[model samples]
Target: MNREAGMILISTMLMLALLALLVVSQMQTVFLVYKSLNRLVDKHQSFYQLEMIAQKLSSFNNNQLQAACLVTEKNPDEVFTLLKNGKACSLSYEQQSFFYLIEELGFFPCMQTVKEKGIYSTQHWRLTVLAKDERFNFLQLRIARIAPFIRCEKKPLVFIHTGIISWRYLVR
Candidate 1:
């Protein structure tokens, strides 16, 4: 009887030890999952913020964008620099900050008659948007496709001879 009682106690202790280890392992897994979810949420928030900034920047007339293109530096990282005319291109939405560059990709000849509405050659531009938030930093830089504009005049109207080619998101 004594031997049987001793064996049962040892078995019970081993079982309890295994249960404790399992509980600990489960706890570690739960913590890891929680951290990953938190990071995902932050990234989601930042993505939307960047999109909003890009839209706002792209929603401007060519003259406005041209004026805002004060920073002539081709490097995107140089956007953070304090420039003599940087404020023209800088934007603040809610709690986020943004900077955009309007680079003239190239120009193509228009097929339309040069007489109708004075339609001339078309120009392509790239609007590169950079956003930062004190609360949620941007996950990636957004490139907004403004349009391939058929220049109507030197004033550079936004929609007189323009159409949205496409708006695709680039992530990296």
Candidate 2:
């Protein structure tokens, strides 16, 4: 009887130890899952903010000489002023809000000037956008151009003109 009681006590202790280990592992898994989910949420928020900033930048006219001039100044300290839907505005990104800036601007030509002598002055705009959140960061660069201008002759000539206007982004 004494031997049986001792064996039972030892078995009970072993079972309790196993249960504690299982519980600890489960808790660790739960914690890791929660951390991953939080990171995902932060990434999603950053993407949303970046998309918003891109849309806002896209709405501006690429042909606007004034805006292009502002870009040429290349002043990191100067905030480019823009008018959207008749309202004056500027872009900013913040942790609680969204933060954005124009990183680069340049001209992209569609065709070789030597080959197409007067076909088009230039052909594409390159815009680089950077987006960031607590967990992740994204860089999106896009080339944009005006609709092709068609010239009818013995052969139709198409000319597309574009210039780098602005790059925008948001960070949190």
Candidate 3:
């Protein structure tokens, strides 16, 4: 072969190699982005499930409260049975399957008494819910309830009270 032809062939091969490297690098970046997006979607779904559980608890009426309270306190094991037995309550609406791995759960009571107008005697109780999944870390839910105490006389009056309490979260 001629000298000029040989040099052209060498240059063309080098250019092809560089082009292949660039393409591979671009593909790797795209793959990493796709993986990150998938992880984010999974995390969002898990968080949605957790929030739904909280909302369900919030919507509980007196009857539901009494039932759940009794089950949890008296027969803790039965709480799962009530949740899973699927005999009386509607579990379809709450996405029960996603929460099947709940690791911890509980409910607590709180009270406040008003001795005078615009005053309150405050007390606190805690209800805790905990769950863990392989896809995510520990998830915990805590609900706080407040009730006012009053004395009955010829006439009864209600008092207003305000306070802020904080709870802590632990992950394992």
What does the lDDT read for residue 160 in candidate 1? 26
| Cα lDDT for residue 119, candidate 2 | 48
Q: Could you tally the backbone clashes for each prediction?
A: 0, 6, 1
How do all the candidates rank in terms of TM-score, highest first? 1, 2, 3
lDDT tens per residue, model 2, 8-85: 999999999999999999999999999999988977776777666666664455455344222332343233222111
Candidate 1's C-alpha runs over 4 A off are: 66-88, 110-121, 133-172
Q: If ranked by lDDT, best first, what sequence of candidates would result?
A: 1, 2, 3
Please identify model 3 stretches exceeding 4 Å from their true place: 61-133, 136-138, 150-172
Q: Residue pairs in steric clash, candidate 2?
A: 93-98, 93-99, 93-100, 94-98, 94-99, 100-169
lDDT tens string, model 1, 1-172?
A: 9999999999999999999999999999999999999989987777777777766655656665456563343553443332222443666778666665665555544322233455445545556665544441322232333233454444534332343344554443
Predicted structure 1: clash tally: 0
Error of 3 at 32 (Å): 1.2
On residues 64-101, what C-alpha lDDT tens digit does candidate 3 reach at each position? 34343423232434433433343222323343332222
Best by lDDT: 1
lDDT minimum window of 10 residues, candidate 1: 136-145
